[model samples]
Target: MSGSFRGEVRKLLLHPYPKRARDQNPSREGFPIRPPLNNEPRTADEEFASDTLRRMNEVLARIQELEDALDDPSQIWPRLRGAWKRAEDEADPRMSEIVRQAREISPVLKDLEKRIRRVLRRTRELTPLDRVQEMDRASMLWLSRQPGRTIAERAGPAQRILSTVRYENFDTLENRVFHSYVRLAALVAREWQREHRQAHGSDRFRLVDTLRLRCRAIACDLEALGVGLAEPGTTPNYVLMQDRGYRTVRQNWVRLLRRERILDDLWAWQAQTWTDFAVLAIVLAIDELDEARPIAQSPIVWRQEAFKGRWFDQDRPLAVFWLEETGRIVEVQARPEQPGPLLTLARAHVSLRVTDPTRTELPRRIAVWTPHAMQRMDIQVGGEDAASRLSEIGQVASGEIMRDGLILTPAQGDPQHLVASRGKAHVDVIALDASGVSLALGMEALREFIRRDIWR
Candidate 1:
């Protein structure tokens, strides 16, 4: 028995059976059986080989069950413990590989949920411009805490005085303007975070400077109208000037006071504010440049597959797959020469039409790429010839179309209800007129460009 067991173990460890041995054994009886030789029967090697194969399969089946259990997320810990037990019992090399793979996948699966939530929140925060204006108005109410006070009543004179302080011959206009606005912003942002101010970059100073200048300008305007600051500024303190300026600031105050109550009622007529959109436009400008870098590196023809199935190309380490309208979009290895279809999906889905026409003599031009081949046909669409054609189009499209006049107006007044019956409307008007060709080719792209880059 011991001799047979020793031979069986040797066969299992050393080598596989030969073709003759394989053909001879119809059924392995936990050991191989040689066919009847002319004189000799079976060798100990054949019997051992057959028995070892049967035992190996049994071991494999057991290991597979443990692997399946380990893959069950609910039983992962128990499966891991079980796998370790089996590994300890069997002392096999394959068990270690399974354990290592499970450990690698666990952390990856755990973090995926966290990453998805962050992306969703980011998308939610990037809503359209209308929402931003509404938020600004809401912020005013929240800040002032007085429903009766109009924005102009509160911020208009303050804004003018800030402007006055900025330009005032205070010996160091830049330094004074910087610190004065700094002080004013300190008051406005007292409860907010240092991070908020940090994020505003130049705007923190600009915000304060603009406010103080506006207040100072208002004070000066009141002086022009024969009104004086409530207190003379013999004091060195800027706050003293600020306080006096606010108290004495006047701008047809009687009309303002009478109509201040109506400010609440006039939301329906308030001009669509462009400040928020302006900020968005600036961000989009950066986005455009960043986006263009890759395209400029290696230009590829990308078409939008919008009508039927949607596809995106993602580059994987191994290969790039041209994903089609199937529910599952697979990552593909990108070719060296061309970008995949996924690359142009943004152009089709998102609008990036640029309307600004800087001089052709200058290095950069807007709308470098347009959906319409005609608009993109020439590199210098805004060259003299193009500009001339655009000017003609602008004249025709120049019919007055009155907009919400509030945010557009420089000074305080009831929001505009007038139509742009004639004359150039704004920078946006000219850009759109020029984009008429591009718009005909792809309105989505043109609208996105105007709304984000120009109109805003």
Candidate 2:
């Protein structure tokens, strides 16, 4: 995320990149109609959340607008009804409060509890007895021996006597519930941690980290209280289920489990399409549009997918960033599905819709990104022949090139793959590592070209 997913998908596009059109079979006697399918998910068993493009964007926005609630409980428990749902509606806070407690407050409480428990409060009583070390010296009974007294006690000395002792007592219901809740919290935190994928730089990671700390605190507090698993809470633990805050904790735990289940289903459904290429494309586009802000923030829908349980739109973008600079309303889109004539070769295209009443010309493709291989597989191609090699590959994929336009590709050693265009450019080829190209610089290059004839 620090890199803004920049050059990230290159891992996905590793090995030799495919032909732009998914055609172009090597010269053998056989002629093939279609290329082998490259439609597998980048990961075999897991799914990426950000891969859920456009759909979640609008839903989150709409929900925020309609409900006017930052954290909508209805989304968590849609069937929630009655005053129970409306509990403390003034603050409308029970659900969020519990989650927040688990997030930030629980951790501190647990830490304090653990530190306190290391030297827990104890009261002197005639119980929790240890070895008999001293006798009640003021009592005459110590001078007299009982009939069953041994010879050592009667003759040698009063060897031992029972006395009051002070020690920690942990057999309370409070201790049992503390242990139970801590373990439960740990389980929930693990799920959230996995969901975050431990990408610490991300906001998700920070939230998950806070929750993890809370879980640890709970465990330590229980451990300090000496709560063991062998102990049973045969009766209902009122401390965990009673009162306002305690009750909210239970509710939050259940809701979190439900959310995880739904997310699991969504992860399964993400296999329908390969949205990574375009997703990364959009990420780079935004990096270039750094100064410009989106017209409106995109909102999310809890469960919005083709199927009932899934989480996102497999084909549409995650969020559409529309930037209005001067008279231009630039809408950047990364259409992987609509890869023009280049089927899907880890390719991308950048075009513009400008309103100029004074100008009259068909909107031609401005910049064509035919990256045969994006990852820096061939560092060998960057010498005196780099330009010629680039031209040849580009021509093969998309016939002819705009002498004054841009064609960005992979050249790992070539900073941003910003290579100068030269002649024929026709019937030649190129293979640029388009992973880390400066999208803004490339776009500007096309706009401020020296030649007016190549007006794409």
Candidate 3:
């Protein structure tokens, strides 16, 4: 019985898979079925390839999103940071490429940020003067780095001065005089800057030195006219300092007024008074500059009649003169009409005369009439053959009239005639008759004539 039990146990252990062995080979038991050794089945390899491709597509999609975000200026830094962090932790080699591109673009992004901040600061600082648009902000940014604080700071005070002068309410004469002063100031400032740069070559210099000598000369003139300067070491209380030339002018004017005990009169002064004084100061300063040159042989006058009584009338002449080198109007003198008072006054009072005939715009035709001869002579002033015409007229007349610059001849035909001349910069038309010469046809008249005749 013991031997039979042992034999049963051995049979059970040896023949445990008898059913599977009966169906298949005993060596194949507990082993997987496979394709041939040389040609493995493609299913597993295909599945693994598809899964890898899907993971790569996801990575590529994330990279594309990151690239698109980096194109924006505001998004550049943020995307770069995120990309750098991802690259540090990532095992993917593609992340390293993205990190390299981000580093390449980092410098350009930083520069753009700096420029934007600078422009914003400038816009904020300049907001008090005017509504600073983007273009104005850019201009201010560029101008802030210029030589002086003039352009950067002067606009506000200039506008304020215009308001104080009541520019919008100016009359014809006042407007002309005011604009002439402005032009003169601008020209002087430009020349001053040029000369300063040439002399100093980027070395720092005082803004006041630009007009120091000129201002001193004006101060001397004011002192001679019974005006006094403020005490030395006194603080300069003037508010307008943006334009060195303008501030110098205003300061001298104030000193003159204070010394004359007429400071309060400025508020009550006529617009014409303001115009005359301002123009006079600017002309004197410009005359002292080395760049100025005489432009006219005789001052061009605009004469008109002012009625005094029922039968009495006076002829007023407004003389205009300019500098040849700068082409800037330097002097405008108004006086009672005489035979040739402008030339005499210009020589005696202002030391300004027209020496360059080519630079001056003389009347096209200068007519002189003698009551005894009862004849009007037309003297041609400007043309291709102006010199010969003047010589011919000079021979026909007695002699040169008015400072030996003008020639007069007797008109044989008509007593009353029209003197036509090509208009110059400020002088438009000049009409000379037996009584006097008239330059009343100024820029405004010419514009009106153009609007009526030429434009039509």
Candidate 4:
């Protein structure tokens, strides 16, 4: 969860670049070595070359992931093979040309073997998951070190263009060329990125366009990380900068490329900390907008009528929904103990019932509790027995609602408002937050649970 070997492999097709050195590659047209010329149209050969390049890149990424996984040979090799096969199936004539040049770095097998052995050895010497946690903490520290900026600081014409093109899907020749460059830049940037694990820029691959490329890479990386977790065995145990020796190798690679006048902005950013949170925040906000509903009014606060004590709940969605539905009336308990920004909402007195994301209207129930509102409880979908069962599972006590007042916080602001409230006795309060939906047990699931006697 902490490190990024998982990210490295999964992101090759989408981002191919490091977060800091995107768009940093020198123009292919102006390279000291003449760019290859194909007088013929994009034939099978050209397509095959492109496919090979992509495949090799993917194989390299798999090697990185396998190394990070410490060659959990039972699991990782099959994955690597799958990656290779996928890349090969996608290959065309252009991919073949790309394959010819790929050996310039190293044969795929040899390079992969080297990277794998290196990563395996490093994993043997260090605890990957712990280091990943450390790296996560480090990334947080890096983000905190920078002053948080508004979206306006970074949003400009480029964003507008990209947004437009994102919707349009770049069909023009110029756009296609640009897309190719972006893809190539991404892979090159990863080379630089693999070196400097810090979140800043590097010196080895500085084009005027580098920052945007890096941002693209990071965005792509995060996106891939999210997708990889959706599948099993794709998530690796290690973070990006887990090994000091790997860091040294990255540094040396940059130093070697320094004479080529690349990697400056990227390396600098790597050594110095900076935050693209303005960009990331915007994207995250956009993502949330698609998933959450806005609560319109604040609910009445109530005393602890249903539940007695305030305690912690790890179900983020459940906790978030509880607060939005019920305002502060009970002796609300606490806040997150970590050192980043804080979010405060009300507590859940009743259980919230809902269906699962993987299944439509498949009923389930979850107990919700928060720091600000204690008496209110929310459930997903279940009966009293199911609620009791889930409550016991969550380790929170059932509470009584003593009084009611509008004292809760919305995700966007500090105003205390009850986003949702149900008048029915069977359903106490249902609130939907950015994280999860809080509601009562649906009748269907309740009947099923009763018929099956599901609760133990």
Candidate 5:
């Protein structure tokens, strides 16, 4: 239920990057970043690394059910993966090479962009200063109290300077930061231009070209403003630590890189082909059932085993929720057909059915809930009636499952329209929302108790 419509479309690059909780997604070229709370929003044309691809995939998946009527749906990511597989089978290598080439240079581009930003911010906050040795009137007056005098200040001020003036001077970059900044910008600009040139299409890596031009423009702008590109100092810049603005921005910049944790809240949906409305229906059913209090006023009990295998590995999926409603215990699991450890607390803890992602049909993705008895013996853990339930478990090594015609999934059409006339029959249609489907399941599951003769 957790991983539904699990598509086999992970496009890996030559270099492996960590898929951490907050992924930078440096591989996705031209992916528009949905802003994190700590970061500034992206400009419409500017491209930077973020979870744009993942969010786009999520949005496309959500709208797949709505647009199911459309034929030849090749634009979505899941569909694209299928298309890629077909191409691979046909021995077509050009498309894959062209697309993945961008991934190779993206990490470099991202790091370059971050460095440029850091240098620019530090340059602004450092605010270059100059030391001017001068003998101004104010300096002379102050010097008169220095107990010097004795013709210390003669005409034309024969000495070097009466005093040295240490003041904030943006007038000349030959002083500290700006001149070195322009040189740094120019160095990065040349490298960026080289990277842009290596990229094939005119439009493909235009963002890199844009960044390259920006770097060049920064150097040109500073030179135009009467600042020479003087030699850079290798000395450590402790001034940045003192600047509150720089300190705050640096902290936020780090946080901004890692803050946006959710990939589902798409700013706007895009294309992808992954269908799992059945999974949603099952999950929604679980939520609906959990919220309702049983008529018998019995509390729900839950049990689970930790998952410790790699992705797509043969792992056990089990979560037991005991509902004592109408004197019955229901256990829910993704793998209900397989032989597993027995349920212990009481008898007949029914589990809602779930299956592997390879099964594309709705019935295979999920099954209607049936209040049947669980397996016995090695499958039976404990309980007073364990002896009786074992005999009913059949001569099978695995468990058994069934369906009761309950509204486990919602009908098609608007939820508002479906609400008024939903009481008529055991209706079936393509559902538009999960909430309506969930409500239907909650009510219908309760009704199944009285309709069945086994409990009587």
Candidate 6:
């Protein structure tokens, strides 16, 4: 019976309209009646099949309407309203029941909408990229809906931010600000280094002091923009503690500075400056530390660890350590152990100290020693002129040197001979090499070397 019903449905689907009049009228006048073609509708069964198919189609359409109403209960309101109006007009018996069902379902629909809104809000907060994508989709949908309006007139902030012209402007501004900071910092550091060198003699010039001056200068610049540093009593401190203005500006700056594009630019600029070496080193070190244990998990504890037993908390880990008599910077990672004394006896993974400044002539011979291996690798610095040779060496080393150490990989030599030089900034590396040499590379040459070789 089910199979027969399915066959009837298939026949109806295959030929929805009535058969041709000629095909249905198989018998001609005064002639013997002829049987219908196998594929043609038979006149005897045509009327009954068409009537059944019509009823079946009506039932299927009604079922689809009910399914749609169930899928979105909002559709039920209009349907119920129409049904109630029809019942009133026709004086139907189900009018009261229909009203009761609608009243019960309305609140459920409202609650579902509320829950959907809440979930969407949370999703937007948790996944910013999703929010951006959604915003773009919404803009496109809106544009399609209102074909009369131009995109510029209807575009949201997200759309504006994504626009080619606007994004290019934003990129340009970011680069300008970043380069400005680097240029200002380098200028200040150069002036301070010149004064210090003049006062204490070139041999006694301290990189840490020069760095402090540079940081103070940068902090001053930031303060001018009404963004306070993490430190207190530095500059004018325009951003008051716990002030809403400060919070707003600080949050904006944090978001801007945290962007990869901005940070990468800042890093490239820092690499170009000799005095900014400590700042770069500190940032890199903190980044390494944070990777070991995420700073977000315990920011307060991380701050304490970062600034423990140092000069100003601002320069604690890098510059402050360089100021010490030993000129050493040690970063430790403790093992799970038994006794307190055993913990004390454990050594740091990175233990670096500055050595005495060595004097060298115009074709200077510089050797670097790896801490573990204690093997020296000689670097060849030679050119047409002393200035060119120093420039060549600085180019080779460049941003590789840090406050704690310089990273060296000797070409065609033993890996053991590769070493780090402590308490020397990239500029210090150039200066130390050029100390006794006449017509040596100046600070500008070293800066150019870093800009050309390292930042590139």
| Best-matching candidate per lDDT | 2
Q: For candidate 3, what is the lDDT?
A: 0.28
Index of the highest-TM-score prediction: 2
What is candidate 1's CA lDDT for residue 429?
20
Q: Flag regions of model 1 displaced more than 4 Å.
A: 1-229, 236-364, 367-447, 450-456
* Cα-based lDDT at residue 169, candidate 3: 25
Ten consecutive residues with minimal summed lDDT in candidate 1? 404-413
Clashing pairs in 6: 406-421
Candidate 5 residues lying further than 4 Å off, grouped into runs, are 1-163, 168-253, 260-284, 287-319, 323-328, 334-351, 354-399, 402-456
lDDT of 4 at 186: 45
Candidate 4 residue 206 C-alpha distance from true site, Å:
13
Error of 1 at 49 (Å): 99
TM-score of 5: 0.27
> Tens digits of per-residue lDDT for model 3 on 1-456?
011121232111111111222334344343112121123236765444333222222223233333444366344324533443333222222222223323332343233223211111222233333443344544555555545556435454432111111112212222222223222333333333332333343222233233333333433433343323333224433322443433433343333224222212211121222222222222333333455443432322211211110111112222234544544443323222322322221121111122234554432222211111112223333321333333343433222222211112222222222233222211112122111011111212322422222111
Off by over 4 Å in 3: 1-264, 281-352, 356-456
Task: Kindly list the per-residue Cα lDDT of model 4 for residues 133-241, writing each as its tens digit.
Answer: 2224444444345443642323333321111011222132222222233344345444433322332342322331253354355335434423111111122223213
Alpha-carbon deviation at 200 in model 6, angstroms: 52
Q: Compared with the true structure, what per-residue lDDT tens digits does model 1 show for residues 173-283?
A: 222322232233222222121212333434333443344344344334333433322221223344323533211222112222322222222211111111111222222
Error of 5 at 86 (Å): 44
* Weakest ten-residue segment in model 6 by summed lDDT: 297-306
Cα lDDT of model 5 by residue, 406-430, tens digit: 2222222122111111122121222
User: Each prediction's TM-score against the native?
Assistant: 0.14, 0.35, 0.15, 0.16, 0.27, 0.15
The ten-residue window of minimal lDDT in model 2 covers 30-39
Q: What is the C-alpha RMSD of each candidate to the true structure, in Å?
A: 40.8, 16.1, 48.6, 30.7, 19.5, 41.3
Tens digit of per-residue lDDT, candidate 6, span 1-456: 011121232111111112232323332222112111112335645533333322222212222233333444434324522432332221122211112322333343233223211111212121222234444554455456642355544444443422111111211222223223333333433433332333343222343234335435544544454432232112223322343433333333333233323223322222112122222222223222211221221011111111111111221122211213222222312111221211112111112222222322122122211111112223322111222322334434221222222222112112221112222322122221111111022223332332222221
In model 6, what is the error at residue 286, expressed in angstroms? 17
- Give me the runs in candidate 6 sitting further than 4 Å from their true place: 1-261, 267-456
